[model samples]
Target chain A: MSNQEILNKLRDTIVTQDIKGCEAAAKEALEADISAFDAINGGLAVGMKIIGDKYELGELYLPHIMMSAKAMDGAMGILTPELEKDKTTESIGTAITFVQQGDIHEIGHRLVSIMLSVNGFNIVDLGVDVPDETIIDEIKKLNGSKVLLAGSALMTTSMQGQKDTMEAIEKEGLRDSVKIMFGGAPISQKWIEEIGADATAKNAADAARIVLKLMD
Target chain B: MTNRMTPPERMMAVMTGQKPDRVPVVPFVLGYASKVTGISLGDFYADGDKCFEAQFASMRLHGYEQTPMYGYASMGAFEFGGEIEYPYGKGQGAPFVKKHPVETIEDIEKLEVPDFKKELPGAYKQADRLASRCSELGLPVSVQVGSTFTAASVIANTSEFVSWLIMEPKAAHSLLDKVCNMFINAIDYFAEKYGAENMLPFDGGPSESNTMISADMFAEFAYPYMKRIHTHLKELGVNSVLMHPCSDQNKNIPHYIKLRNEIGWSGKYVWLFGPETPVKTQVEAFGDHDIVCGNINPSLFITEPYEELLEICGQNILEGMNSPSGFILAAGCEFPPNAAPIKLMAMLDAAEKYGRYE
Candidate 1:
């Protein structure tokens, strides 16, 4: 099959939430001797990007996104070993992401983490309710490598924690070492300025684009 | 004419589709009440007396048209044997489901309906006392109950609930049925004290927002349950319901208006933050029972310089007030606890300035 055909098949499997179809597509790409990089970039990444786009457009929901994410992750697993020989361990920029302390609702941040991973950024997901110290610890533990410290606040009540995290980074002497970004229902461009965040994202796709630009 | 009407009278006038002396400003004032009352939020919640005082103080401070039955945006899962982390003190964000009670289909199968009034003792006592207090003072009261979908999110935890919707949808429905029963039981308890038509808030889960879910998924998972509850309340004679589905509900706005009409919620019912639904669009689509609640950005309420913010907010007032649909000035979502008092005043101030009919 042509690469476009294989990519289209893979994307359909994800959008349709056909997990078995995703595995079969990965196997078909292998038989065609498609490079692992293209298989992932052109196949898995393309599928996830569509999922993200549809999600933003409100054409999709959590179940579809969740089911598709699982499918895409499975296909990536099948292709990663094949790419291991040619791909360097140092893939690209690193991002440290979490739900700021006291804000536990994190599906948005989780999607952003998944999208960032698919787009080849190293994601250090600290899960929900992460303290500034943990974020600082993750950055310093990276041994002077630049990283993106991303946080999200689902509640307006906890939005102050985003600013607190930023202040904590500055106090911990890692202010210049990392760029902070936030996203959620409560954040706006005005509030983003009030809080002093480096950037704000509407969704995972937007987050990926911004993270890529920040890295550049 | 504007200053002659008391807060409750002004609010009542609008609910019945009459011109109040002025536009009624009804921002959601829950945790923020504690801040103005000089009580810790935990005390306000944990102690019913303090909660009552805080609510009243919040009304006096904000010049809100209703007595505060204001409460945490929770589904009361903790009272129903779910693990919830109640925010214990000041600056603690709202409580949330700490651990989901249902992890498997078996867990869902074993669920039993808890006694609503007995389960949430503090909330009931507070609501009962607050209602009586408001009654004596001739004030209006507004309180919120989470919808079955939101309660299910709290009871099952959101991540697991989504999995159930996909994998074990039958169990998901069963759990939602159980939570709906809990809500009904609570409503039944409150309906006796508060009038049949006076329930203030019934939240449709934000997870069911069009931005968060597909129409198909919402139709299957959320719509039926919400319709069932709305129909249930209608049967009980409780008519006025505030359905706050936060964050950009433009995708589901038509369905919202349709659902309310279909279920015969003919009294004052609002779909707040069908966010960014144009005022003109809302009036045209909402038809006869059309009432525009709010679409103002809640984030704007926290920033500085009340005057400039009032100018921006004034546009929303002018448009909503000009619409044939009856209007109430409110934030798209809850008034942030940290939102400066002055900024909140600006919302009401704008309402009075630009919302005047005379």
Candidate 2:
């Protein structure tokens, strides 16, 4: 099959969450002279974008978005080493993911991580129940071109943690360097703007695009 | 003037937006019940009789106004043939899809509309037993119906379900429709058997979680199905249709209020907001449409001291009472099984102390 066809096949496999198919397609694309960068962008990245669009447009739901991320990761498992071997890659973007302290909802943040990783962004997953200091410390460590500070909380009391984390970033003089995106059971655009966040997506796909735009 | 009522009677009154003796306290007490009955969480799920006994025992012990039957995680997938594994002592866990039964459009074509009588008699029988027990105890029984998207998520596997929404909208809708129909049937059977006056169809859709999809998506996918269920329950003589959507669902409360208004169920339906939801904002948004229930952090029951629990319960009841429309004190979600029983009792005590109606 042609390289473009291989890229197209990889996209389909990832979109469909065909884990085995994605891995095989990734290998075939690599063998058929497809550049790792193109394979990552045209194949995995494009498929994720389609998933995101569908998610935003109300076509895709959470479980499917999650599987698509898994599928992308499956393909990435095969392509990551190739890109590292070539050592000729460009940065897509960078994101910081975490479930703020007192909020133990990570399924959403995990999806954001997968979407960002597949889209070629560096992700520093701070893990669940993360404190403000920990998030700031991670941001200092990664120091990516743009920071995607995210939080998820399933309860109202923990909503303050999101506000507190963003406040800490601003207090630490790191607010300008970072772009905040918040989503969870309770977060809203009003709350995001109220807490001084840069942006808030309704779901993970919008989150991915919002982070990319913030980076741009 | 109406005579003052006890906390239980007051709670029932408040649920209908009447002047209760004061604000009623109905702590979400699934785990609290298990602990009260000394039944292991494993026994609660594995044996329906034990689960009902524990549930009734917990409610009676705490003087709880409502009993939340069924785990939030179980409802979403169980009806769709998903396999569930309960870890007993551990909290409720999500049901995993052992088989995708619907792999393609042809598979969808072959899919049969689930016959609740044939398929869910065991569950309904359990519900019947619980309802009977609750009736004997002169308490109310509330059964949970899995939320459409969350249910779909479990059946399709979270990622696959979301992906299918985007990749296969028609198929997703078809699948959701089937699940909705099955739940409606199950709810109707339980309502009829249990008496509609005793039924509360708790739609466990986590649309408010903000993790699943956008408000627009919820308006399309989650809200309509909920409306249908609510409408059907109302028609079946169920006076109250309480929705238990977990998450910071502040944005969606208005939508729920609108649904209640459109369905002419304004005073009858109760919007059970999760503790993660911004209560003040939601109360303000809901503003007299339907009764507002909950926002007590469930974790507090397990973590907080009895005094602290009373203070929070007292404060929430006071706040709700201050409103033109009254409130029902409830946990954000199901009360964790390990929650200190004393704390739940303290909540009841606080309601009795401060929830006195003039």
DockQ of each model against the real complex?
0.52, 0.15
lDDT of 1 at B170: 89
Looking at model 1, the pairs that clash are none
- Specify the highest-lDDT model's number: 1
lDDT of 2 by residue, B1-358 (tens): 3655654776666776678765676676664466667776666666667778887676666666776465445354445544555434122222223455555555656656567666463245555566667667666666766576676665554545556665677887887787678778777777766677777666766643554666666776777877787778767778766677775565566577688677776336576777667557667866456677757876566446898788888887776656556677778776655555687787778877776667
TM-score (all chains, Cα) for each model: 0.90, 0.69
Candidate 1 docking band:
medium
Residue B176: error of model 2 in Å? 1.2
Mind sharing the TM-score for model 1?
A: 0.90
- List, residue by residue over B85-179, the lDDT tens digit for candidate 1: 66663225676667677766788778777775554533555656666666566555555556677677767767667867887788889988887
Ten contiguous residues minimizing lDDT sum, candidate 2 chain A: A152-161
lDDT of 2 at B286: 69
True lDDT of residue A60, candidate 1: 74
